[model samples]
Target: MNLLHANDRRGEYPASYYTASATPLAPFPMLKGQVETDICVVGAGYTGLSAALHLAEAGFRVVVLEAHRVGFGASGRNGGQVGSGQRLEQDQLEGMVGRTRARALWDMGEEAKTLVKDLIARHAMPVTFRPGIAHACYSQGEADHAKVMAEKLARDYDYDLVDPLPEGLIGSTAFKGGDIDRGAGHIHPLNYAIGLALAAVAAGVVIHERSEVHSISEGARQVVRTGEGQVVCDHVVLAGNGYLGRLEGRVAARVMPINNFIIATEPLGDLARTVLAEPVAACDTKFVVNYWRLSDDNRLLFGGGESYGYRFPDIVKTVRKPMLEIYPQLRDVKIDHAWGGTLAITMNRLPCFLHPRPGLWSVSGYSGHGVAMATLAGKLMAQAIGGQTGGFDLMASLPQARFPGGAALRWPLLVAAMTWYSLRDRLGL
Candidate 1:
């Protein structure tokens, strides 16, 4: 069975709160017959769309192919948290890839947030970009670990964005005590995604919905085949992330698709303040993280729960499990919408950027931090194809090892490991 068909309604956005609030655009025509462009981008989420937009602005003819509508995947249905740093913390990243590369990556992480905000203003997109993301902890040990990390970030990187929560302050008990990343924030993910699509289109990029890339034939030139058409281009950008089937061996082996679910509560009114005192997004320190933020309309959009298989778990129950633990006062609240989206995760939680051969590229495996970095990755991909390869090369240079036992047994292995970590979260270990 097709994984895309397995999870979501074909060619339509999932029934999510984001979909309800977003200003819908008329669906673009499907790809048919032959086409040629300087670059052919697969997947129309932030990554591919950003590449298309940046490339178009740089005067490169770009074509974006989407299996469904634009932003129909995780881009539209995420927690909307634009977090700071890589998925791995800076200190941890330093250990993995050295201090210098980690610092450069940290600077790039900052640039990603700026790029997102700049794009929002440049497009005059109707999406609201709010600042301040508070990271929550469940235990004193967790809180202390967070404090140490915050201090490390400030001391080593010369960055003072993360502030540790006071002992008896606003978010002390509910989230234990954590830190606030003032430089990071959240957004209306679906609207922002639609805005990016519009910007890319206006910049002379052609985007085709319901245009799945069936196969790729590569040599001096590349031919990307769709059901009804083909795009012959000089370069290919495989930005499909989790939804992209087994298109390339390297990406498939390195990046494993997993499902995550989110639930939106009905408008909380004055009760919103009771749930969260401020207009900041908060994510907890769990292996399977629990992130929640207030929507524009005061609804708590809570995201948690993960599945290694193709089908989504009970969305409402799965997400609400952790959500209720944090906010037991929401027992009477009604869940307005529940949705699940697939995202790629590498073993190390860092993104997997591959250039297996000349002129062909695949950048997926964002783990859970896609809002800013994925968009930045697109621009970097454009820069790489345009011959200025410094930034893109930096990302590609990060090591991404293949899953043990390859794709066949990776599922069972990861599932067992995830179960153990989830158990630890429950046990407060």
Candidate 2:
């Protein structure tokens, strides 16, 4: 099934809290005839929008083709946490790549966070960048490890934005302890995406919504075919992430799609303070992580539960179980909205950045950490297209392995693995 149309209505945003609160953009026209550009960016999420904006500013003609509305996928539907570092921790990265390259990745990760904030400031986006994300730990051992990692970051990386939270985060007694990263933060994800699209438009990037790319004929100049029209461009960026399907077999083999659900509770009024004494986001150390933060009007925006299949599970039922686990006091809270989105993941959880063919670039598989990294990925791709390939090359140099059974069997394999891990989480292993 086409994930783009499987769970959601065509040309409509999910009934998400972000959607309800965000300033809406008028829909762009669909591709109706042949169009030519310097670059054709497929998928108008953070990655495509960021790349298009940067390339347009650099004086390249750009066209962004979206299957649905801009930010209609995970970009708008995520938990909104702009995390620090790569999806893998710095130590893990050091083990995978060398210390020198690991440090460079760390710098890039830091730059990603800065880039998100800079985009917001530069564009004057209608979004607030709230600071601090607490990494809540379930066990004391896990808590100790977090403290150690924080220290390592300070000592080795000269980054001291993390602080130990021995009493746990978000006033939750279930967590033994944790560490808070002040440098990393959260935002209204959909609004940030809308902001990126606006910036891209202002920079002369043409966006065509509901223009799902059906195929690409590659050569010196590539032809990207949509339902109604086509785009012939010198370069093509595959930024569709989870909804990309098998548009490119190589990327599909490396990047597996998965579904995650989030729910918003009714405005808690004064009780919001009890849920989160401070307005910071917190995520626990579960195999299926539970993340939450207070919305602008004080509604609890909780994201949890995982689905392996293309169709979404009953989102409110799936997510509320975990939400209650984290905040049992919210047992009686009324759910205002619930939705799910597809996001891609690699075997190692590092983003897969590949120049699969000449004039064709694929960037996806951010695992659960794409908000900042994907934005940076876009900028790096634009830079590479402009003859400055250093940043993009560094990211593409990271090893990304294909799924053991390729695209066909990846879902079942991932389901089995995730089931095992989730069982361990339940058993407190």
Candidate 3:
């Protein structure tokens, strides 16, 4: 069965705590017939919606087609951390792409953070946009390395938002030390995505739900075909991410899909202090990252573990195992909700922006650092459509590697790789 249909009800969000908290919008009609637009955007998640909103603002008619509800995929269900910089750090990025282009990418990374904060402010989104992300380390050596990376950012890039984690800041006893980035932040991602959809409608962009695109035929004008209808437009953007499947050959090569799960405990009230002393989000050094923060209701919203398979494992047991290790005190806390999301990953953990054909673009594989980068991608796409390629071109210039064994064996290979990483994480290798 198709994972999108098997895993989710068409036009509905998952049974996530995010769904419980989000202010639901009225469902848009499904595409029943042919339509024409200046741009056709597949997937109404952050990238597609943001691109539609900005493109509409630029006086282009845009239509966004979502296979499910807005934010139904990783866009709505992610860890919610608004990370700074690219998925690869500046030091590593400099080595890969050289200083000049790395400098440009760094500037864009900063722009991404600003873009999120600006979108929240300008649109007056209800999602709480809070500052600070603490990177917890498992050992003193890792802590020192974290601190050095923070310092390196300030020294090399003249960006000074990160610092060593303060004493007694995080309540986890297993952590040696950590660093916090003032530039980084978190939000109720579902609400933010819904807010984007609302804003896109207000800006006159059309959105259709339950619009699973079958294929795109490019000619003088691009024709995006759905089961029951179609969209004819001058340009088409493939922003489907993990749910896009293998529709586009180039994106499928670099963007491999995987599942990540999360759990939210019952309101901890004053006991929230036993987890996070502050409101900042926290992510650990594990390859399969343990990311958590306190919800507005004072519950611990923790996300951990990853699966390369199409189906999700036991969501509660999968995430709670790592969560308990971090906060053993919460052993008895009630798990209010549990859910899994799908996100695309690239070889180098950087986003893949592809122009597979003229007038057609594909952007995906944000890895885990998508909240800010994905939003920035929309703006960059809008800029590119308007004859500006400075930022988008730089990002597209970043290289991406294909899965080694083509289609059939990619999942097994990634599973093996992830198994080795999980072993190292267990033994602290």
- Tell me, by lDDT, which candidate is best: 2
Every candidate's lDDT? 0.89, 0.93, 0.90
Sorted on lDDT, best first, the list reads 2, 3, 1
Clashes of each: 0, 0, 0
Runs off by more than 4 Å, candidate 2: 166-169
Looking at model 2, which ten-residue stretch has the lowest summed lDDT? 165-174
Worst 10 residues of 1 by lDDT: 165-174
Q: Give model 2's TM-score versus the native structure.
A: 0.99
- Per-residue C-alpha lDDT of model 1 across residues 1-429, encoded as one tens digit per residue: 668899787799999999999987899999999998889999999999999999999999999999999998889888898988899888788889999999999999889999999999989998888888888787888889888988898898888888986443343255668888888999999898899999999999999999988999987789999999999999999988988878898789999999999999999998888766778888888889988888889999999989989888789999897888888888899999999999889988988888988889878888999999999999999998889899988998888889998878999999999999999988988
The Cα error of candidate 1 at residue 10, in Å, is: 1.3
* Model 2 lDDT tens row, 1-429: 899999999999999999999897999999999998999999999999999999999999999999999999999999999999899889999999989999999999999999999999999999899999988899999999999999999999999999986353475667888889999999999999999999999999999999999999978789999989999999999999999999999998889999999999999998898788789998999988899999989999999989989888899999998888777888999999999999988989999999988899889999999999999999999999999999999998988888987767788899999999999989988
Q: What does the lDDT read for residue 66 in candidate 3? A: 90
Where is model 1 more than 4 Å wrong at Cα? 166-174
TM-score to native of every candidate shown: 0.98, 0.99, 0.98
Q: Pick the winner on lDDT between candidates 2 and 3.
A: 2
How would you encode candidate 3's per-residue C-alpha lDDT over 1-429 as one tens digit per residue? Answer: 566876777778999999999886889999989999999999999999899999999999999999888888999999899998888878798899999888888888889999998998899988778999999999999998888888888988898989888887888789899899988899999999998999999999999998999999979998999998999999998889988888888889889999999999999988898687789999999988899998998989999999887778999999999999989999999999999989999998988988888898778999999999999999899989999988788888887889898988898999999999999999987
